[model samples]
Target chain A: SQQGEEDPQALSIQEGENATMNCSYKTSINNLQWYRQNSGRGLVHLILIRSNEREKHSGRLRVTLDTSKKSSSLLITASRAADTASYFCATDPFTDKLIFGTGTRLQVFP
Target chain B: EAGVAQSPRYKIIEKRQSVAFWCNPISGHATLYWYQQILGQGPKLLIQFQNNGVVDDSQLPKDRFSAERLKGVDSTLKIQPAKLEDSAVYLCASSLDIGAVAGANVLTFGAGSRLTVL
Candidate 1:
């Protein structure tokens, strides 16, 4: 079963604009991770944020987690056309298994 | 480092036919997973393995799907008498181990095998 659900099923923006995507989960998690998938391809791990940490940054990507609200958000700064892809948030709820969200399709127009 | 590898990037078969997919995880990785992703949906875990040992397969359709990772290395997923609904992308992923510790269980995924059952 899917534990997380991402908001804004689809979003389109021009190049250089910041894009923010939110994910909500139903239960407590040890960590939350974000992944990117290009059309007809496999998923690529972008970043991971542990429950103990509220936020983390990797290059142009920033991720924030809120265990109390069972939610997390991914921010892409100065988005480029290369950033066009589907983003998904996965949660490991006290288990080795990771449950993925439905994902948000991001389209960055050049 | 070379990433996980998968075979037969795409496949198409008729209902009731059998098909198999192969995966070779990163070197030394002890945990491997197979996930099924339908169109417009998230990838769902079908099974997980830890060094040739079954860790979890609660979601797998045992009647039609079977997977094996012999010798704790390469793995294969097979489906017999496939159904149209079974058509989807099969993703293979691996991790260092099944240790659930934060920041230590990141998974690396392969390019995935797209299956189309008619």
Candidate 2:
């Protein structure tokens, strides 16, 4: 079963714009990680924000975690055509299991 | 380091046919995982292994799906009597370990096996 839900089931934006999505989970988590999947390929880990961390940045990717609300958000700045893919949030709970959220499909047009 | 390897990038079979997918994780990674992803949805955890031992199989459909990691370095997922709903991409991933805390490890995934059942 999915651990959470990702808002904005689909989003379309022009290149150089920014895309943002939110995820909300049910249980307490050790960390929250975001992954990106290109069409017909496996997922690639984007960034991870530990429970104690409120925000983290890697390149154009910025992620924020609010443990109080059990929610996390991923922001991709200056999105490119190659950034078109599905973004999923996976929560690492105390049980050693990583359950992924529904996912947001982002399409960046040139 | 070589990333995770998976075979038969794609497969198509009719309902009730049996099929299998294989995975070889990066060297020395002690944890292996199998996830099923339906189109337009997130990947779902089917099973997880810590070394050669099964750590979790709560979401696996026992009636038709089974997996094994005999040597702890290689793994396989088999589906007998596949159903139409089983059509999805099966992904294999691995991590170094559980770490001092249970769920703190990051996973590296394979290209995935796309299964299409008619």
Candidate 3:
């Protein structure tokens, strides 16, 4: 079963705008990682945030983790058409297995 | 360094037929994992290997699915009598293990092999 659940199943925005996706998990985790997948392709790891960290940034990506609420969010600023893809959150909860969320489909129109 | 490699980007086979996919992880990676991802869903772990030994296969269907990672580098996953529900992408991932330390768990995944059961 999937331990993480992403909200805003689908989102659409114009190019140069910002997009935000949220994920919630059921258990404590050692880390939460985000990935992006193009259509019919493999996933690309974006960023990873440790449980003790509250926020981290990578270029245009910003991720926030709140262990108390068991939730996390990924923000993509200055979105572009090429940024259209599915974003997934993977939770590593004291196990080797990474439980992934359903994912958020973001479409950035140029 | 080269990323994880997988063969036969796509495969289409009839039901009840057998199919196999091969994967070679990046050099020096001691941990390997196989995951099955269905369309519109997240990937699920099928099995995991630490070196040449099985670390986890709790989710694998022993009846028709089997995997081997001999020599602790390359691995293969085989499915016999494939079912309609087995049509999905098989992803291989690997991570480095440094001296039995439990902190090195980040995984680098391959492009994956897509299977279509007819």
Candidate 4:
């Protein structure tokens, strides 16, 4: 079973616009990480937020985690055509393995 | 400084036939993982290894799938008598260490091997 589920399974936005995706998890987690995958490619790590952290930013990407609600969101600001990809939220429990969500597909039209 | 490496970027085989994929993690990485990703879904952990020792394989189909990471460097995943549902992408990833608190073993994944069981 998947530990996390991302909302807005598919999204489309023009370049330079902002795109947001939400994820809800069922279990407690030590950390939540967002990853991106170009179609037919392996995943690329985006950012990881620990349970103690609320928000973090990397370049044009911002991620927020609310442990109390067991939810998280990934926002890509000033999106570019290169940002077009499927985004996934992965939760790591107290153990080693990471359980992934269904993912959200974001399309950035140029 | 190289990234994870995987061979046979793509393969097509008939059902009931056996197939195998290989992976070589980034130099010096101590943790390795294998994941299965069916189209339209996220990747699922099939097995994890911490330097030649099995860490977790609870989700693996032990009856047909087998993996090994000897000497803690490279690894291989094999499926005997493949089934139609076995068609998917197999991803291999690695991290510097499983216990590095600062890093927490953030993974670096390979391009993956796409398999098709006809």
Candidate 5:
């Protein structure tokens, strides 16, 4: 079963703008990770944050985790048309298995 | 290293028919996973394999869906009597031993099998 839920089912923005996606999960988690999927393609690993970590950054992506609230957010700075895709948040609930959320679809127009 | 590989990029069959999907994980990877993704929804794990043994099959529909990893290298997922609701993309993924290490659980996904059940 899916454990995470993402807010803002869809988002539209212009290239060079910033985009943010949020995810919320029920129950405690061992860690949280984000993934991206292009149209008709498999998912790609974006980043992961352990339960003890609060914030992490990679390239133009920033992920913040608040275990107290069982929530996490992904920020994409300077978005691009190429960045247009669906983003998903997955949770590892100590079972060593990742359960994904509904996902957020981001559309960036050039 | 080569990434995970899946067969039959797409398939179309009527309800009650049978279909099978194959997956070959990256060389030496000890973990394999299968997920089902309906349109506009996130991928849901159907089963997971650690080596040639089953780790989790709680979400799998055992009545119609089954999977196996014989040599701990390649795996197959089969639906004996497909249902219309089973029309979705079946994704295969692989990763290192998840429990053996904390940072080795990042998954590498395959291109996925697009199954259309009419």
Candidate 6:
């Protein structure tokens, strides 16, 4: 069974706009990670936010975690055309295994 | 360092036939995983190995699917009598270990093998 589900299944925005995607999981997690995948390629790890941490930032990517609500959100600021891809949120639910979300498809139009 | 490597980027087989995909994880990585990703959906964990030992195969269809990680390094996943529903991308991922240490369990995925069953 899937442990996480992402909202806004698909989003299209201008290259300079920001894109935000939300994820909700069913159980408690030790950490939440975000990844990006280009078409026909493997996924690339973006950032990971531990349950104890409320938010994290890397480059233009900002990830916020709300353990109390079992939710997380990823924000890509000053998005670029290269940022167009599928984004996923994976949760490590007290185990070594990481369960992934349904993913959000973000398209940046130039 | 080189990333995870997978073989046969694409494959096409008729239903009831057999097919196999190979994966070579990053050197020194001890944990490897196989996931099946159907179109427009999230990847589902099929099997996980911790240094040649099976840690989880709960979601694997043991009846037709099998996998092995020899010498705790390279791995192979095989499907006998494949079905049309088996058409999807097989993704291989690996991590240093299953350790609980923060920021150490990130998985590095391969390009994946896309299989098409007719």
The runs of at least 3 residues in candidate 4 whose Cα sits more than 4 Å from the true structure, single-residue gaps closed, are none
Off by over 4 Å in 2: B100-103
User: Taking the candidates in order, what DockQ does each have?
Assistant: 0.76, 0.79, 0.59, 0.69, 0.78, 0.73
* Weakest 10 consecutive residues of candidate 1 chain A by summed lDDT: A90-99
Winner of 3 and 5 under TM-score: 5
Model 2 over residues A1-109: C-alpha lDDT tens digits?
7898999999999999999999999999989999999988999999988999999999999999999999999999999999999999999887777899999999999
Which residue ranges in model 5 land beyond 4 Å of their true spot? none
lDDT value for candidate 3?
Answer: 0.91
Name the regions of candidate 3 deviating beyond 4 angstroms.
Answer: B98-104
DockQ top scorer: 2
Q: Model 3: what is its DockQ?
A: 0.59
RMSD of each: 1.0, 1.3, 1.5, 0.9, 0.9, 0.9
Report the number of clashing residue pairs per model: 0, 0, 0, 0, 0, 0
Q: Write the per-residue lDDT of candidate 5 for residues B15-64, one digit (tens) a residue.
A: 99999999999998899999999999999999999999999999999999
TM-score of chain A of each: 0.99, 0.98, 0.99, 0.98, 0.99, 0.98
List candidate 6 segments past 4 Å from native: none
Clashing pairs in 6: none
- lDDT string, candidate 4, B1-118, tens digits: 8999998899999999999999999999999999999999999999999999999999999999999998899999999989999999999999888767664558899999999999
TM-score of each: 0.98, 0.97, 0.96, 0.98, 0.98, 0.98
Local distance difference test, each candidate: 0.95, 0.94, 0.91, 0.93, 0.95, 0.94
Residue B35 lDDT (model 5): 98
> lDDT of model 5 at residue B36?
98
Question: Candidate order by DockQ, highest to lowest?
Answer: 2, 5, 1, 6, 4, 3
| lDDT tens readout by residue for model 1, B48-94 | 99999999999999999999999999999999989999999999999
> What lDDT is reached at residue B98 by model 5?
77
Residue B80 of model 1 has an lDDT of 99
User: Positional deviation of A22 in candidate 1, in angstroms?
Assistant: 0.5
**Per-residue accuracy of model 2 over B31-90 as CA lDDT, tens digit each:** 999999998889999999999999999999999999999978899999999999999999
